[model samples]
Target: MKESGRKQGAASPCAACKLLRRRCAQDCVFSPYFPADEPQKFANVHKVFGASNVNKMLQELPMHQRGDAVSSMVYEANARVRDPVYGCVGAISSLQQQIDALQTQLALAQAEVVHLRVRQTASLSNHGFGPGSPNSSGSPSSKLMGSQVKPIFDMDMVVDQASLGESMWSC
Candidate 1:
């Protein structure tokens, strides 16, 4: 007997239809987003929001927006499952808090950098590198001794983080 046109290696029903124990129609709503291999994804969505609601929402949307809507629903459903109280909002809030803390640290570090610069300028002024031709004590002998005093911070080692960030923007 000749074989029927039906391919022997046919694809199985999608997660939704399989979980619901129903035959997957050719135009099944969940087929595109939820494949047969990954039943957990559909289960997650189903657990959070029933399949009926998802189907209705998908049917109401325009074809162009459906894919994005499905992806968003899946992501939101996943987040909701993970975080019961706040879901995606909790994740966003945590990220924002981290950003705020980092910004505060950056401000402190920048202030310290400015302070170091001022102190360095003052130190240089104490030596021959400043105005009024060297030390405030008023002795040329102090100028000879000033050369022995080491700089607070090596100028070559000091990096201006703000300028570096601007350069990264240009790149």
Candidate 2:
């Protein structure tokens, strides 16, 4: 009986060995990680970092760290292939910029809410319906301004993209 399982004499080569056109040894380090099914995984890694270099790296790393190292290398390799110049850094920068823009938008929205609240309070005072007034109880404005725990702004409010470039504060 052959020890090759389904195959008689030869065993299926790993992706690395298949790409390199070499025999996949029984103790091959890459066989466990780079299976024959997913050829593109190894191909991208090989394209970004040479097979020799990858082999050396895997050999140098401890068994426990090998998987994480391989995952990081694959991610960086894929990113490098997509954006040769900036790679992962460009993606990170873009996400950070988006965060900053959203923060600014949030600040602007909060400021507008405060401005409107001040106007409403001043109008109430002018009409003798301020917080201490007799008619303040059961008033819609008093109920809205007092004892409200939740944020006043609608979280899903649409922001105007055109206003992103404008100054955050206006006189």
Candidate 3:
């Protein structure tokens, strides 16, 4: 009695045929488990089985099984490709949210700047020389002279100079 090359005793089949064990033809090597027509579906098979073994197994599958395998492979590959695109879309949406938040902050900052400028202008005018100053009612020269009132320190200086000469003579 010649023993077949197939490994025995492990009823657990490959991941792909595990769910549909009944659908898989008992042949084990190339049955429905190895769909060769779908090259991409079996793309990862080479990683598990050696390339030559996967090729030989796929080649032995029936034409209909090969076509079904190929279709399944394409669907799997498309899903893999879609995952990254979906992730990128999620990233873009988050970025847009951040941009919107920044824009709102910028708008608030601009409004605060305008409010500060208005307050500054109001304070300057109330102190009498900005655009709405009361000094506008007076003649320009009078307004200028009024704005330049003699410093109180100059009187102190004159008194100090007068006392200095007397103090020096006394000494």
- The candidate that achieves the highest lDDT relative to the unseen native structure: 2
Off by over 4 Å in 1: 1-9, 131-171
lDDT of 1: 0.74
Which regions of candidate 3 fall more than 4 Å away from where they truly are?
A: 1-85, 132-171
TM-score of 1: 0.70
Provide TM-scores for the models: 0.70, 0.73, 0.31
Candidates 1 and 3 compared by TM-score, better number? 1
- Model 2 residue 105 CA deviation (Å) reads 1.4
**Ranking 1 against 2 by TM-score, winner:** 2
Cα deviation of 67, candidate 1, in Å: 2.1
lDDT per residue for candidate 3 within 1-171, as digits (tens), equals 433333454344444444233333346544344443444444454433444655464688776686665455445445545564464456567788887777666656655655555565465466675646655654333454575564222211222334434543341
lDDT of 1 by residue, 39-102 (tens): 9888988988899999999899988898998888889889999998898899989998887777
**Among all windows of ten consecutive residues in candidate 2, which has the lowest summed lDDT?**
153-162
Deviation in Å, model 2, residue 80 alpha carbon: 0.7
Alpha-carbon RMSD of each model: 7.6, 7.2, 24.8
Model 1's number of clashes is 0
Report backbone clashes per prediction. Answer: 0, 0, 2
